[model samples]
Target chain A: MVSLRTKGSFLKLYSWLPILILYISVLNEFDFNYLNLEYFSFNFPFILIFFFTLKDFKHFDYILVFIAGLFNDTVVGLPLGISSLSYILICTATAYLRNITIRPNPVKDWFYFLFIISLINSLNYTILTLFFSFDLILMSYLVNTFFTFSFYIIFVSLFKYYLKGLND
Target chain B: MASSRDDFIIAIRSAFLKKSTQQKFSLLTLVFFSLFIIILSSLDFKVIRYSKAVINELVYRSSFIVSVPENFIKDSFIQVKDYTNFFNKYKKNISELESLKSNYVSNEITEYENRELKELINDYVSSSNKILAKIIVDHDSPFLKSIIINKGSKDNIKIGTNIYDQSYLVGRVIELNYKTSRVLLLSDLNSNVPVTIAPQNIQAIVTGSGVDSGKIKYIKSGLSGQLIDDSIVYTSGTGAIFKSGVPIGKLKFFEENSTNEYKVEFYSDFSQLKYVFAEIITQTSILPTTQESNENSVEKNNPLDAKLKILEDELNIIEESNKKFQKENENLKSEINNLNYKVLNLNNKISSQNKTIDQFNLDTDELKFLRLNLTYGHKCRKSLFNNKGFIVGSAGYKDCVLRKGKIDG
Candidate 1:
């Protein structure tokens, strides 16, 4: 009986791992900057949120994603709600995509993610520069978008493995 | 076409309004909430500011807690890298240490002189205390370069407080919370510092290139040609935002598209900073306590108090210079007196030598007369039989005998 209870608790922990990872990524800023590569960075939270929300994972609540965005802004020392708005917009885009599609294709999803992140990053750049008067490098944003888009497929594959394990 | 348009409208409606079973708020509501927060944060409302500060305090603490594992891994990686290059780094550091030690004494004297001059110029004496702060979170974001430190308003850290890595200026505090603050590094794109390039003494502004170095901007057109590599860049303190003469970086030149571009390489590497010092400054005015009322009356009567103050400072400097000259004059007078005393002793010794030489000449003449008397006494000396001779002791007899016995004939 004790063994069965332990197994059930372990399964529950495993099921909640996606949200846990999301929180950890935002708080820890899980960009591998220790490599010391110039102009090398990717938004791990963006990839995580897009993949999980697109699949409509049961435990991946939109509210939690919103909170994670707040945490990200605080960690990155940006004005509050900038990242929260970005995260919510991503969820909205994914929700709209989920509604329109009868059969999901990874290639179409990938292209859609590219378009969504580009739009979102442009909006971020516009708001920060116009509203906050921030002097941000246009090249940094472009590079970040490119790398984030390119790394999506690799992260999607890893996330797929996690989801597959959860299904079992 | 009508069917596809209707489907699109239906999908859009669902995406905005629909909520999952586990979700509490619809996507549309969250979007509005985020927009409201953005507007509220920009407006500077008192309650909103307090709430934001509270959130920052909580979030920063939690982030520190969450970053520990990653920090450990990062520290381990850096430690391993450090070990790999230990010998080379040690060799370089030893050479640097030797040069730095030589500079240390002159630097201390200059610092003392600078302090005294500043005190003389400004009515208020500004004293600074640099408190140590640990960088709790250093997320090298692509857009913004900032670091969160474990010091804030509670530690007397205020907005615009200057931060340093050792003695080199690193950044300044922009946001302060209860126990944490954010430092906007000099490498951020938004950061601009008024600096003076040394040796040539060109005044210019340095703006960050969103990278490791800063770009020189707003300099005089022709003066750019005068800048050379390794020229020291230090704060000019023009706007009073930063302290004067704080070392910022060294000037570097790189060719971009066949055009010379100047950059500042900061002394402190922002990426490698683990601990920093946040300088807390306290200012005390030099108020006239003794004759306050009289000074106040004089200040009110004279519109030229500032000019009078300048003249008073000049007078004080002149008086100090006069005192130094007086002391030097006294020393020269004593030196002259000792020299005159030596000259008098030399004159006395010359007179004594002249007297001794006179006595020796008299004795030589006497000896010559005695020798002559022995040889020619029989021929010229006076006796009972010879009336032409005189006594030997007489002056004429001595002269006649010394003349080789020749008489008047």
Candidate 2:
């Protein structure tokens, strides 16, 4: 009976790993920024949010994701709620896609992610520049979106492995 | 087409309002909440500001805690990389250190001179205290280059306080919390510094290139031709945003599309920063306590006025030196007077001693004459046979006494 209880607890922890990782990513800013690569950065939170929310993972709570966004904004020194808005918009887009889809395709989801991130980045750039009077490089945003979109497929495969383990 | 339109509406509504089993709020409510926060944060409300500060305090601490493992890994990686090139780096550093050590003494003397000159030019003496602060978070964000340091208003770290890596200017504090502040690195897109290029002495504004370097902007036309690579760039202290003469970077020229472009490669690597110094500056009026109240009424605002003040100081120095020369001249005059008085006294003493010597010589001659008269006075007697003998005191009588009563022949 004790062994079964331990197994159950371990399973619960495993199931909640995605949200835990989300919080860590937001706080840690898990992008390999120290690599010192020129014009190299990707938003790991965006990729995580898009993939999990599109799959509609049970433990990936929207409220937690929103809070993560706020944390990200704080860490990145952006105006409050900017990252939250972007993350929520991603959730909203994924929800709309989920609602309209009869059959899901990873390629379609990936392209949709590219479009959503591009739009979100554009909106982010506009808001920061026009509203907050923040100086930003459009090229940096373009590169960020490109890198984030490119890294999504690779991370998605790993996330799939996690889901498979949970199901097993 | 009607069915498709209906489907689209239903899907949009579901995306906005629908909540999953484990979800706490619909996506639409969160979106609106996000918008509300953005608007509220922009407004300067005391409550919002204080709350944001509190949130920032919490978030920064949490972020530091969360970053420990990652920082350790990053540091270890860097250490390994450093080890791979340790010997070459050591050799280079040794040569660099030797040169830097040679320059260090002159640099300190110049710093002191600069401080004195600044004090003379301005009405206040600016005393700066540099307090060491650890970098709590340096994510090196591509969009906005900034770092969170473990010092803030509690540590007298106000907005615009200059941060430095060693002596090189890194950035300034832009946002301050209670125990943490955000420093906008010089490499940020929003960062603009007024700088003077050495060797050329050209004034220009350096704006970050949204990368690791800064681009020189707003130079006078035709001055770009005079700029050479590796020229030093330092803060001009214009607009009083940055302190004057703080080393920022060196100028590098790159060609883009057959056109010359210049960028400043910063002295401090923002990526490798672990600790920094935040300079807290306090200014006090330079006037003496006795004259402060009276001088306070006088205006010393413009450069011309400062020049006049400097001239007045120089005049005072010249007056002091002149006074010293007059005192020395008075001393020399008294010394000459004392020497002349001594010379006159010596002359009187010498004359008296000469008179004594003459009297002594006369007494000896008289004694010799008396002895000669006992023997030769009979022969030399004027009344008897010696009419040739004169009086004893006369020159002829003295010579006859010495000749033992002999005649003139």
Candidate 3:
């Protein structure tokens, strides 16, 4: 009986791992920027949210994701709600993608992620520049999008391994 | 085609309106909430500002707590790197210290002179005090470079307060909360500093390139050609956003697409900064309006008083000049005394040399006379048979011997 209870608790923790990781990533800004590579950064939260929300994971609450976005903005020193908007928009896109598809393919999902991120980044650039009068480098956004798109596949594989473990 | 389009619309609406079982708010509701927040944030409402400040305070503290482990890792990495280059860095620092030490005394004097001159020029006396603050969050984000410091309005950290890393201007406080403020680093894309390029004295704007350095902008058409590598860039106090003459960075030139691009390499590395100084400036008017009015009344009542006041100012200036002149005169007097002493010593040396020369001449004459005597002794000697010369020891005999034993004809 004791062994069964312990296993159950472990399973619960494992099931909630995605949401926990989301919170940790937002708070910690877990990008390996300390390596000091030139123009080397990727939005980890974007990848995490896209994958989990598309999977429609039970524990990946949209409200928590929204809160995580707020935390990210605070950490990154951006205007409040900007990150929240971006995140919500991503969730919506993934939901729409989920609804319109009968059969899911990773390759299709990956390409769709690229399009979504590009659109979101362009929107971000426009809002910051036109509304906030911010002097932002368009090239940095482009590079960020490219790197995020590239890193999505790698992170998605790792996340898939975790999900498989949870299911088993 | 019409059915497919209808299906796509239905999918979008379902995505927007539907919420999962665990979710609290629908996607549509969250979207509207986010928009509401964005609009609220953009407005300069006092309540919204306070709310934002509270959120910032909480988030900053949480971030600082969360970042402890990462900071340790970063510090360890930096420490390891530092150890590798320890000896080289020490040697370089020693040489730089030596040069800086020589410049320090002159710099202090110039600073004092500058202070006095500024007091004379401006109507208000601005006193600045730099308070040290710890950087709570320094995430070098690629988009917006900024840091959160543990100082805020409570500590008199107002917006536009200049932050410094060891006296080198780093950035300024843009947002102030209760106990924390956000400093927009000079490397932020939004950061624009009015700087004067040294040696050339060119005025220009430095805009952050979203990198470690800043790019020079808005310079005169031909002035960019005059900028050389390592030319100093400092705040010009043109917009009064930053204090004048605060060193910002050095101008660096790099080739891009067959054209030279000038960038500012900041003196302080933003990434390595842990603590910074926030300068709080308090300005006091030099003369009160009441005093000015009293002076005006006095001048109108008696023009002589106005003349006397002018004379007093003139006297003060003259007194200051006189003190300088006195110092110069004292220096001149000491110099003159030294020169006079040197002249006396030189005269004594000349006289001694003249006496020695006279004695040498006399000795030479005696030696020549003796040689002549050896050759023509009998011809000039005065004796019982030969009485052509005077006595042997006489002056006349000595002269005649020196004259080659010849008698005056």
TM-score of chain B of 3: 0.78
Instruction: Give the per-residue Cα lDDT of candidate 1 at B334.
Output: 100
Q: In model 3, state the lDDT of residue A96.
A: 100
Can you tell me the CAPRI class of model 3? medium
In candidate 3, stretches whose alpha carbon ends up further than 4 angstroms from where it belongs are A1-10, B286-409
Candidate 1 segments whose C-alpha is farther than 4 A from its true place: B289-409
Across B191-227, the per-residue lDDT of candidate 2 in tens digits comes to 9899999988999999888788899989999999999
Residue B15 CA displacement from its true place in model 1, Å = 1.4
Interface RMSD of each: 1.0, 1.0, 1.1
The true-versus-predicted C-alpha distance at residue B65 of model 2, in Å, is 1.1
lDDT of 1 by residue, B135-227 (tens): 988986988989999999999999999999999999899988889999999999989899999989999999888888899989998999999
- For each candidate, what TM-score against the reference? 0.83, 0.81, 0.84
In model 1, how large is the Cα lDDT of residue B393? 71
Count of steric clashes across candidates, in order: 1, 0, 0
All candidates in order of lDDT, best leading:
2, 1, 3
TM-score of the first chain in candidate 1 relative to the native first chain? 0.97
In candidate 3, list every pair of residues with a backbone clash. Answer: none
